[model samples]
Target: MNWFWFLLFSFTSAFVLTALLRRYALCKSLIDMPNDRSSHSIPTPRGGGVAVVVTFLVALSVLLFKQLIPVDLFLSAIGAGAFVAVIGFMDDHGHIAARWRLLGHFAAAIWALCWIGGLAPISVFGEHVNLGWLGSILAAFFLVWMLNLFNFMDGIDGIASIEVITACLGACVLYALGDADHLVWPALLLASSTAGFLLWNFPQARIFMGDAGSGFLGIILGIVTLHAAWTSFMFFWGWLILLGVFIVDASLTLFRRLIRGEKVYEAHRSHAYQVASRRYRRHWPVTVVVGGINLLWLLPIAVCVTWYGLDGVIGLSLAYLPLVLLAIKYEAGQAEAG
Candidate 1:
């Protein structure tokens, strides 16, 4: 597959562009100013994710122009990504309300559902269950939820970018193993772009993803994972296992918020990553923790697609372990401090 050069090129291109654009955003006032909910002390360039969007869309467009992908799926996926990116960009600059973000997400979801022609309810060990129209609706909601979760999780330096890179690496490995060819390109493109953003973001914060980048990335990665899941029962587990970090942190936090009667829709710096970042009084430590988990831990599971053939849709559900522990510890610490 000649993936050696491809991977190298994707990573290098994304990193350089991300670093340069980040500096440009800072000079041009495309920065996220410090506020109450922000952990960053200084004004940082926002929307460095434009580099991600550019690399992904441009690469995908070239592939499409050369007739490399299936016409229907390629166009639909790219269209949805572009649509969401515009909405996110507006929100980043204009601080658009939540309602508007939901509207755009819903619209993009419906577009994806139409593009994918509905999801097939997947069971790994049991019989495959198709929920018919209900499945499509549920899939849309799940996609939107994933998108928002990714956006929410981007509150700290390198968290979202690292997660995105992990997801891409997972997809790329699967692709190299002949799991799914179509899913690999988009994932690698986004992953490489994240490499670019992380250079400035990690160690010391210089720029942030803002809503534009995080939301767009979440939606793009969400759709790619959805596409992989529909490939078969085995592929579904691969995608889920890849997303363990994001789903666990976001799902548990939302559950906690719901239980506490907190305003779930409002912005709050209460995510486990946020809590750890604040508690530790450093951003890179939390960033390194996530990266370490992804590299040392999650990467092992991701390799399961190539090694043990552990692709049951339910097996990947076990990816919640670290999340449960981290959440419980973080919550307990918060209580203890109070």
Candidate 2:
């Protein structure tokens, strides 16, 4: 089968599955009710992300069977991805204590790291430096952080879906430019899967991604990033640049909340994008802007780092500077204004 067909299958499967999931959510009363920290006003069906997860994983298996993806990478994606997705699915259906969830997240991270052969040496100032076991530890924490930040950023309608689509598509282009064609399938398939879900998730969402979808995307992206790093340190930097928006906003918000002596684990709507959504009295505009930034701004920098021999660290700093300013401009991590 042509790879294009796989992409089509992924998109169609997700689209059909999302519609079915929404109906199921309605039937089961699996709804997200508005609260003080909630982004949407109306109670809506949640857990629509399960469709994306199912579509991507099934697509990944097909790719593996066709020998399009390496066995190690496939195992990593399936084992770690399914583990986190199951955890998130359970949490979405009910409650999982924060501590237990965190533990499960870490376990999943370690599982992925083991399968991916731990973190690769990174490029800094044009030099490859290995962090040894410290790098492994940091990579595990990074995976966990990515998982949680994705969940944190999924506050408003379409934002998370948009981010995943843009970021994954952006990464696909980078892989093509870098001549790492083998690395392109997973990212492209992920984007296709998310694109299908986005149809239902855009502003005035009929269904929400919920924990299962967000966490699955987070850990999967993290694993893909680490796997790409092994191919070229520049690819690692490129992926970081590609994901700058979510990383910067979520990290900055958590930092500021922690500084203010707030319980960082508690949910709040202080994220820059969340604030922007509320201020604009709409969600699509915010989501659209995010997509624009990824494609127009970040994608070029990622290309430079991956294809033009730009120093990875320098490229990362350049990519993040404006984003950091944007976060500050939106008062990211600050307390909600009364």
Scored by TM-score, the top model is 2
Instruction: Report, for every candidate in turn, its global Cα lDDT versus the true structure.
Output: 0.74, 0.92
> How well is each residue in 53-142 modelled by candidate 2, as lDDT tens digits?
999999999889999899889999999899999999999999999999999999999989888988899788867789999999999999
Displacement of residue 278 (Cα, Å) in model 2 is 1.2
As for candidate 1, its clashing pairs are 15-196
Q: RMSDs, each prediction? A: 2.7, 0.9
TM-score of each: 0.89, 0.98
Error of 2 at 236 (Å): 0.5
lDDT top scorer = 2
lDDT of 1 by residue, 215-284 (tens): 7888777677667666655565666677777777788888877877877787777777888888899888
| lDDT (Cα, 0-100) at 324 in candidate 1 | 74
